[model samples]
Target: MKTTRTAEGRVRAVIYVRISQDRSGAHLGVDRQREDCEALAERNGWEVVETYVDNDMSAYSGKPRKDYRRMLADLEDGTATVVIAWHTDRLHRSPTELEEYIDISERRGVTTHTCQAGPIDLATPSGRMVARMLGAVARHECEHKAERVARARLQKAKAGEWGGGIRPFGWGVPTGETATKFDKATGEEVEVPVLDLDKAVPEEAEALRVGADIILTDQSIHRWVRWLADKGFTSTQGNPIGHQAARDLLMRPRNAGIAVYRGEEIGKGSWEVVLDEPTFRAVVAILSDPSRRTTPGPEPKWFGSMIYRCGLDGCTETMICSRSGGANHPSYRCQTRHGGGRRGDKLDEYIEDLIIERLSRPDAHDLLLPGPGDVNVAALQAESEQIRRRLTDLAGLFGSGQITMAQFTEGSDMARAQLEGVNKQLGRAAVKDPLVPLVGAPDVRVAWKAMPLDQRRAVLRALMTVTVRPARRGRMPDGGYFDYETIEIGWKRSAQR
Candidate 1:
């Protein structure tokens, strides 16, 4: 192949620049690297033919580096006689990548020049050894740096300090200033921000509290997203909130003043709490419950649909809402096509009245059963952690061929079943009781009416089991309607009728 050159026979050069992170998207780091590489090229009398950049990309991460690949293609086609970089480490942190680069350099008879490491001549054995050694040292430094950063983050979590990231939703924004403070444990000066933790942003904090209530009350996350949009609340990226974002906001452990590392709760956070611990845990349980409806299907339009039972002899199947006779004739029918169907409007009205009357009594609070407040949360969390560790170790053993397939399957199934139970317990504990608001209300009917249909259904399922029995055999008058006597309501709790 022919090597490209300029007037005066100067070697054609291509500069490659990269930075691991460009949080501001400003390319400032890559700009500095390019300037240094250009100076090196000028000093060597090499004509700069092209420049390639991979901004906010890490060579060690195994992610594709588009511009880097393009530059390699340019080199293979003999577009440039030499490649310039700020440093060898900037060019590669993986030994495999370095080896590939060396192979291309050898085939193309191209050489590498760095501003920091000087020239690396791939044509000579001694030069190749030096390049390999440099690559090894760079790889070691990257791995060691990763270990240090992980440890630092864990330490910060244990100390209840805010580790650096995007500003949390409710937290105050950083002013981009740093101050030095002497660390008591390390006995060294550490740079911290002058203004870091203050009271949470009032409006955002309020929004979080409202969100927690929405989840606790069994309202849809779709509702929460609409609420967030209505309040003009955007994410840290200033984008409108979506369903997942809305759920994430409610699920954040920090809202309950809890410190977490790698998704595990470490301790309390050194910040203001927007939600009480019990309430926060309950909301999490409700959202994470495996049985919770996530995929879209037919949503219940009536309170008794899919919940009330058919009290017909030998047919006690659950009932479902049907509009077979048209919208005006919507009714609840037994799932097994049992003898008769009940009008949806009449059944819903009777159930609503029964619930309000039961909750309106002076002793209504007694009907509320034991809630998540009685759960041993710490013990459950510990057991969950242990099961996870066991699962990880089991996988490792299986991967190494230390255990038979049968043994692995048995162990995994047993451990998973136990984990499932533990998760369900935790979820139950975290879910808030729907009856909390309606019970002991000054205006019970008014408060019940204010609740959404789903929450009202929750209260119904919690308080009583309704069964629609077959209509009594008798000749009815022309204008006669639904008989409340045919509906049997059994109280779930032991309370005075």
Candidate 2:
């Protein structure tokens, strides 16, 4: 039979130490544990690979530490063969975690040894059983301690005793006195002993109260956090209270005198409630009302307020929507005939009707409609591609520090303009008849209703471009109200194309 070597080349080990609180003066167990582990490693010819210390973190919840998890990962990856700790309890105070650790040790061939408990050989059935039993006892102790603490807190709360936790917003513990101190400014209780009203300046106290109100009413906890940071408020540990702390402070109901601790009120006698019961009820009612909620309004009309010049010469004024009649019968009058110009001719709604009738004809439709041949897809694609390339290049230049801020901005603007032009061209090519089709489409009404004011301007720009010049009366072949003449209507499309 081959004998297993008692000592390998060199045992690599990691040391993990922890303390739940800064009670170093009361208990030097952690220090002593560390010393013992170090001595053990030296005597066994083992190298201390790394030391992971998790101070002030209770292992009751089996909450894994960042450093502890990293050490585990390293062990699995062959970084360390052994783990050294004060005892099994130091590694984990929970049975579930200890069982997991034992399984990992057995599978990964990693050894766990404690300063007081000696080696935990998980590969052997007897050793594994002992470890599991120890883990159970530790977990039971932790659970029992937690239950006792919780019962004590509940009893204190029922008796209206100040169960130790966070301090209330406005009340503070009295200085050199047994009672709590009340904030004169907001009349709220400050529960923290160090944050007494006498210690805080009048202005600072006022600001804190105001910031707390803003946080509660506006639900802007971030603003309150910023205010606390600026004022140099910190936790009991002398570290700044994080964003979560500010949120908790604002949400605590004990400051408002409504918090039920066990069966009694804790800080009721110390602080005044900012939001009383009646006011809170009113706010809830308003928030729950459906009628108070806001929704988006209707879209604006493109030519709702703009003036449109008529094509008939001698018209005193341009065509306008009728105030009394419906939009369909709205007529354009020659300004001169109406009273200002030469030969005045009134262009009734018949002109618009005639234009619509002509557009419906197959011959006219073919002439106006955009066919496949009319669209230059390749040219449009090239223009879009160029714009995209320019945008990318400008972004690259900005990233590489090759272009100044102003230069990058200018390049971006130009590229955007080019891209917009290409998009307009493509849009126009897709339409059968730019002006008429848009006006006649059934969806135009919906589009008009859905569009905003800015989008309305874009629509107007797409339909018409130039001012329609009125036709002269004598220039018409027949100088009568009923005269036949071909109308020349000029309009502008978007310059983007």
Highest TM-score scorer: 1
Candidate 2 achieves a global lDDT of 0.55
User: Residue 71 in candidate 2 has what lDDT?
Assistant: 71
Instruction: Give the alpha carbon lDDT tens digit for every residue of 74-160 in model 1.
Output: 999999979999999999999999899999998888899999999999877877899999999999999999999998997898677
- What TM-score do all the candidates reach, one by one? 0.75, 0.42
CA lDDT of each candidate?
A: 0.83, 0.55
Q: Model 2: residues >4 Å from true position, as ranges? A: 1-8, 21-32, 177-252, 261-497
Residue 351 in candidate 2 has what lDDT?
33
After TM-score superposition, the amount by which residue 285's alpha carbon in candidate 2 deviates from its true location, in angstroms, is 5.9
Task: Tell me which residue pairs clash in candidate 1.
Answer: 281-430, 282-430, 282-431
